[model samples]
Target chain A: MWDTFILNPMINALLMLYDFLGNNFVLAIAVFTILIRLLTLPLNLRQQRSSMKMQEMQPQIQAIQKKYKDNPQKMQEEFQKIGYNPAESLAGCLPLLIQMPILIGLYRAIIIVLGSTPQSLFELTARVYDYINLTDLLPISNKFLWLNLAQPDPLFVLPVLVFGTMFLQQKLMTPATKKQESKGKKQQDDNPMAGMTQSMQWTMPIMFGFFSLQFQAGLSIYFVLSNIIGIGQGYYMRRSMAQLKEEQATKKPAVIKAESETAVASPPQQSKQDDAALDAAMKGTPEERKQYQPRKRTSKRKRRRR
Target chain B: MYAAKRPLRRPVIFLLIIASYLFVACGVQTANTNWPGLSTDGEKVYVAYGPEVVAYDVESQSKTWSFPAETNPTLQFFAAPSVQDGRIILGDFGASGGMLSPGVVVTLYALNDTDQGVPGSIWTNGELVSDRVVAPPLQVGDQLFVGTANNFIMSIDATTGAKQWEFEVGHSIWGQPAYKEGVLYLSSLDKSIYALEAETGQELWQTELSGALASSPVVNTDLVYVASFDNQLHALDIQTGQEKWAASAQDWIWDAPAFADGVVYFVDIQGNVYAVDGASGDQIWSQQLNLPVQTSPVVVGETVYIASGDDLDAENPQGALTALNVADGKQQWQKTAPGPLFTTPVVVGDSIIVALQSDQDLLIAFDLETGGQNWDYLPPQE
Candidate 1:
């Protein structure tokens, strides 16, 4: 099932890419990596959006946890009120989990396509689709820029690059623990997810970098290119999220001032509750967020005209 | 509490990743160890499959001797051993420094053919090359010509295991070097056929074909017949390396064509066997078996034997030895084996010996005239 559905399709697609892409295998790999990343963009965006939403609701979540420590059902109800699903937060790992199969499949595909041995070439004959003129394509060019794609890189350049790029991507994808940074060790103690993500940020890159040391340079090319693309996607997502937060903050000053004025008239404990509620409202629904986005766009256009 | 359990998640995932990597790595490593390389010297047939190289006596149908006596896990032999005058020469695929070293070093060993069932090394070329030797070393009198996977053709003294001369090609040479009248002919995966001086390893002439040649060139007195991945069998001029005529096949012609009595017989990877006139690349007769045949056709007298296997990755992988009339391409008889018969069968006396990919029967002997199985032998795995 794996071979027919995932591996064979991937192998043929790579071969097709190699055929039309002027036989420049490295270029083919780069383009294919970008294409695959684009295909999985929706999943990545969903994961990123979920993570951002979870990050935004962190303070409110902590408040609920502290208040409803004695009432488990009430804590669950409060989490729902803040539009936070713990299950959805766990599903944030889904995008990476889905990518695992793609990585494994592409690894096998690269090994077969850039096969340096006869037996591997022989096995490739069986894996190739009938329409492909494998006779001409026999012995896919493994050479590119002093690197034999079939073998591991000797200069140690790729491994280091893989480590650096993967580390950067992981850093970007990992939700910044602003609360944890401010609160220090106590915040880390309170939120296990922060600790897990931090550990993963280092561990994942180191693990893949070690893998790149042994794996074929072609696979390392895939890793490096994939990580670079991920970095771009991560940068875009973080920028958009930051813009959205900025727009929300900019549009909410008048409402926040009005609430603060009403809170000053009310009791002290009510003022604190109102302030927390205002913060939750600031991290509002997609509808509320989209309303402020147009104003930021208009302001940018006005600045451009100037 | 969640924080305590969270640390365990990464360790579990890391273990899974490591396990998956090991599994994939192990599978890929076993996929292309270059099948069993079989060769014969009229009296004994040598089989080099995995860790050991063993020789089987043709007449007695028993083991004559095996080199090293014990299998080394690191060292693997896949190239056919060149047996000549009580000396056997072969090269290991490679052995690395296990976990510490990243480089693989291949060694060439010259062993004395002994009466004691275990051959001793005459001279060992320890780490002579950094790449694997996929092509069998061709023994020409005192010098041995070897082709490596890393695009190097080496000439080593057969007696002392000393380097004679080394020539680098454009790509890997998977076919054994062919020698004729002090001139060496080699087909490379670089899509070119190279002619080199046997004594000096100097390039004489090179002929670029349409596609890569994985099989050795069959050189007669006049022409060098090269089967290539271009789906064509090219006849090149022996002296100048100019293409004379080419015969097309359905798929890649992976092995050297057999030349006997002015006729050249070869099989494509798609199992199409064709007989062509050696002088002119005209097809005389063609037969379709519809199975993958990577081994060269062995023509003894009037019968041509071809070994074929169907889908090595299949659940019940099967192979056969089919004997056909050399004149008409008519089927004489066919015998099936338990596993894929990848190596070309070697004819000795009245029986033809074939190497199988199965563990149950590593080597099988069949009657040359009749389709009856003579005997089957499996070497010691230890």
Candidate 2:
């Protein structure tokens, strides 16, 4: 499945793109990497939403904890009522999982195309095959610029660039600041992502940088492009976060109306903390977007129960 | 020089690996650049010792004066001195060691009566011994012809060493060329022997031999004899390379086969001698000696001489010089010493001088008839 979905198609596409664009392999790899990032953009967006949803629920979670500080069962029941689950916040991991096969394919393509290294002898099913010549018109061997495709690049420039781009992407994509729990009124303003720490931030870049020195330069170029695209997507998503915030604010007035209806039926006034939360949710245009609509218990409660 | 992308330093290591494998698989040979010249003149023995043409006087049992007449500042003596037309012609057949390239130069020298009786340089040319020449000169009329390491058989002016013409053969011609009335015979490392016109070097035809011919092509009156590493003794037609008849030996036929009155005397690597009727190419007698024979044979009137060994016993090492009766292939007498001589005996008039090399070295002489010890001369330092 990978040969068709990733390897063969990517190889053929890269070859075709190289043929059309003066057969410049380095440039082709950069363009190809961007194309792949664009194709997987939807999955990346869903992962962002999942992270945003988790950040918004941090305050509600704190409130649930305060309401039943001594009763663990009551806290759990309140969490079940609200859309707050620790597991759903891990949505960013899906993009990485989906890209694993694509990443390996890119590695192999760079090894064979840029380094001119053939696949392992065992993987070769036939005695002869068509050569994918990148330097077909060059007078000298496929060595060019400062790199020798036959050997590891000596300049160390490519590896550094690859790691730098990865670090930049990671830093820019970090949206929320991790926060500590408090014994007061709950607020989603507490940074949800500040919890992600430093161990992985430096470790991943160092490990990949070390490997980039040994791998082909072409793959290094692709890696750099992938990171750059990821950073750009992060910026775009962050820029559009204001719209998401507005949508959340617009749904707040209906929440307050329902609370008032509850007061008329069983009680008159509720806790001042709940009033403050509903007011915060209705502070902006959230009140205008909120409308009284029929809620589907089958999809909401049943799905949450499962 | 190597490509920037490719690691060229490893190739030298790879060659070492290859050489080591060959050392274990096949064997190594002692390399000697001094050529011991071969001839059919029956009166004189010519050799190139260092820079001079030295000839041994058959009657006086002493070497004639060394001739410095033929000197090439750039060439070396790769093969022994070939005596032709009362002159000593030496080929610079990679003997100098600097020109690892092929195609040696052939230089001739004549006795200068005015120049203090020293042999004076007459003429020198590259046509005679063109690179990698181990073969002696084959004289046809006024022109002397020989093959080269580059796989070309050429004719040169016997008096001037000027090239007349050339004919490309299969591979490097390591064998000494042979000649008949007008046809020139040559063999190559590519396992093919060719017959060419003496004057123009035009190819008449080429015959495929079993293996490479590294030995000197020995010739009789009617039959041209040659040996191959394929362990085959071929008697080819004098005018064409067509096989007159062929004989087989136990191992690679490396040395030039000696021809006597009516029989062809040759040895195999397995220390066996087979006397074949020269006219019919029939094996009249076969005898196994002590060890393998890689050297050529020396034959006189009714007796044949061969060098054989048994085992490398350090002190004895199975080395001996044996003389056999040609008629019955029976050993007449055996001379034992620290010897496994690689050179053929030079029979000068009544005494035979053989250079025997073993742990020690000496040039020994003996009477031709009774094999009595005459005198021995060992080089002072070496």
Candidate 3:
């Protein structure tokens, strides 16, 4: 069932793409990765939005943690009151979950399409549909740039590019914590979770770079291209969000300006109820906070755009 | 409380990503490693499987000896071992730094029939000829001709294993070279066949075909019969390398054609057997066994024997030795095995020997007259 539904289709599609792209396997892989990214753009956008919302709630979440340091059950109730569920926040990873299988399928497809060995070539002939003519594509020229698509890049250029692009993408996705910058070195050192997140930002790319060194160059090409495309998409989305924020600021300039002045005049005199509500909204699920607070009409506009 | 779990998510996701990386990394290493090829000297059968070449004695129904004695993880043999002058000459697809590494070395080893040591009785070993060797070596006189993944047909001294000459082709040569009367006929993945001088490695004539040739050509007195991936067989004139006639098959012909008494018999990968006239290239009769056949048909007297099996379907995959009358293409007898048969059947005296590409058996012998099981041999389990 897996072969019929995923692997065979991917292999045939890859072969078809190779045929359509003038038998250039490297071009085929690049085009295929771009097509896949475009097809899953909506899912990626949703995940990005969910992540941004989580980042936006970080300050209030930290405030809630500080306020309820001694009351664990109360904190749990507060989190529920704010409508937060840990599981629901993880919905942002859905795009990645969907991409994993496709990536694996593409890897297998590239290997099968290249058909490096006699046995594998025969197996490819069997997997290929009869209508898809690959006679001229037999013994595919794996040479693309300085790499052989069937083998890893000999010059280490692809691995380095893959690492660089992936790191950039990860850097764009991981929201830098302002509290960490404000905290003393000693406090930052004491927080193991913060340390782990920082380490992961570097480790993920290095690990993938290691994989790119071992996998076929064709697959590595896909990885590097997909990472670069993701970075571009991320940048575009971030810019759009920034533009939306600017438009909102312009529309409600007087109200925000007055709040800023009042906030500056007496930082500690803000109402405890307002603080509690903000904390609750931060702890709550994105949907729950949107329902409970209902302060921003732009959220509805954003939904319409999505 | 949710903040407490937030930190755990990163580690979990990290582990999941690492797990997936390891899964794909490990999965890619398990390529299609089985390309079993065999040769027989009428008494002993030599089969190449992975890194070891084992010689099975037909009479004793046991392994006489295996090259290297111990498996070398870097060494992998796919081409059938050519037995001549009491030596086993074969090429290995060697990779350094684990199985996934791209560096491949086609090392040719000539081992004595009976010798065991740490390095184990290798008479002469040649340096790397190419990235890989998938075609069986052809031994004529004192010269050994083997085609390589580097698109070169190399001639090595059979006794000393020294490279004598090399002929570069348009693409990789996956088919064994056929030699006749000072001329060598080679079919390549470049969709062309060339006639080269056996002594000097000079091309005499070349003829382009419709598709890449994956099977070796069989040379008659004046004609060379070769099969290609285009699902057609071409009979070329040996002297001029010109296509004399062409015949179509059901699928890609991955096995060499067998010729005897003006009739040429060949089988495609789809288990469709065709017996064509050697003079006119007309299909005389064809039979379908519904199993994929990678081995060429072996003709012994009036019976044409073929090994057929399907490895793709696990549930009902069948392997059998089907014998048909050469005159009428009628099924004389059929004997079934536990798995696929990828090597050609060799007739040794009264028994027809076949190598199985399955876990249950390594080689099996059947009675030529009755198609009854004589004995089966399995490699020593490690």
Candidate 4:
């Protein structure tokens, strides 16, 4: 079922591209990867929107965590109220899930198409569709620059490029804030999620680079090209989201200004002591403010009990 | 609400990445060590699989001896063993520490009939070539000719295993060399057929074709028949190396065309059989079997036997052997096997022997007239 639905179709498409591109397997792989990226652009856009929404809610989520430090269940409820569920935010990876199989299929297709050995070449003949003419493409000249498409690059240039492009894509996809960047080991220990995220950013690229050094150069080419496209898509998506946010902010500035004025005005009508306490709470650190909150509420409850 | 489960996502992503790597690794790291070249000399049948060459007695269908006596895991053989003057001559693709190595030198070994390794019988031993040697060595008189992945054909002294001469071509020579009189004919992936002096390795004449030639040239009298990757078979004059006529085939021809009784019979990789007139290059008859054929057809009297495999079933390929009438291309008899037949069938007296490309049995002999199974031989498991 996998072969019929995924592998065969991918193999045929690659072969067709090879035929159309004058029997150059390298060109075929490049074009096929681009086509795949373009085909998944819609899904990727949706994923990017989901990611942007999560990024936009990070500050509110941190505030909620600080407010509910003493109430674990309330913290969960507050996270739900703010629509900040990390698990649901991971739906952004759906596009990657879809492309993973295609990437693997493309890798196999490159090997089969290159037909390095006699046995592999015969297997290629079997995989070829009847409508596709592969006679001229037999014994595919895997030569592209100094690398043989069938074998890995001797100079390790492709692997380095793969790492470079992938790292760039990951950086663009997950933009860390300046505070997170300046944070030391102690800060990372305090926020375990931040540490894991930072580690994955480096680890994934290095692992892929290692794979590029081991697998055929043709596959590495796909990886590098695909990452570049992903980076471009990420940039575009982020830009479009920023533009939309800017437009929305522009349309509602007066309304936001009115709300802020009203909030400030209401605090002064509570009482002199209450106004001073509110000012101190607003100026204090998150931990100090949370401590101040429980003390004020406990005093009021004790007075009510007496 | 699901933020509490965020800790589990990292491990899941890690597992998915590992799974993707494993999936691609499995597909890319397939066994590239097939193409078991088989040859027979009436008394014994020699089969080259992986690195070892085993000889089986034709009558008893029992193993007689194996070259290198002790098996070496790294050794790989792609060229069929050529028997000449009580010695088995074949080429080795050499060994590598792993698949990532930039390939090693190709060695030609000459072993005696008793399976004893001859002293100093390794020609160009440890000598690095451009690539591996997959073409079978062609033995002529006291000299043996073999082509290398390095795009050079070398002539070696059969007795001393010393290099006599070498001829450089435009591309790698994957097809075996054909000898006639004092001239040798060889085809290369460079889309050209070359004729050279067998003794001096001097190029006499060369003819350019439309596609790369993967099959050895069949030299008969004044004409040479060769198949190419361009899905066409060209008949060339032996003296001038000029094309006499070219017949179009359904697909690529990877096997040499068999000539018998003024007719040439061959099959394409797509299992299309064609019997063409050797003199005029006119198609006598063409039959489509819808299976992939990598082995050449054997002609005996009025019959042409071919071996084909259902390539879709990669794990357990089913092979079909069909006999066609050489005169009219009519089906005579058909037989099926559990595995694919990648080696050509050999006719021994009244029995036909075929080697299977599978894990279980290596060889099976059938009665030529009745198409009945005579016997089968399975190699002892390691």
Whose lDDT is greatest here? 1
Expressed as tens digits, the lDDT of each residue in B19-38 for candidate 1 is: 54553333223223668999
How far residue A126's Cα lies from its native spot in candidate 4, in Å, is 4.2
Clashing pairs in 1: none
- Whose DockQ is greatest here? 3
A1-306: candidate 1 lDDT, tens digit per residue = 999888889888899999998888898899889989998999999998888777555545655554555788987976786577889988988988999999889988887787666777887888899899876775677778978787667677887899899999988886767444364443443455665666667777776766666677898999899999989988988798778757866888764343223211111112355445544554787444222210001233456999
lDDT, residue B10, candidate 3: 64
Positional deviation of residue A255's Cα in model 1 after best superposition, in angstroms: 10
| DockQ ranking, best first | 3, 1, 4, 2
Taking all chains together, each candidate's TM-score versus the true structure is 0.85, 0.47, 0.84, 0.77
Off by over 4 Å in 3: A62-77, A80-83, A179-197, A248-306, B1-30, B72-75, B98-102, B115-127, B158-162
Alpha carbon lDDT of residue B174, candidate 2?
59
Give lDDT tens digits, candidate 3, residues B66-98.
Answer: 776667765677788888777678787654433
lDDT (Cα, tens digit) per residue for candidate 2, span A164-184: 888777665655433222321
lDDT of 4 by residue, B279-301 (tens): 99888999888888888899988
| Lowest lDDT block of 10, candidate 2 chain A | A117-126
True contacts kept of 2: 0.00
Task: Give the clash total for candidate 4.
Answer: 0
Residue A142 in model 1: lDDT: 78
By TM-score, the best candidate is: 1
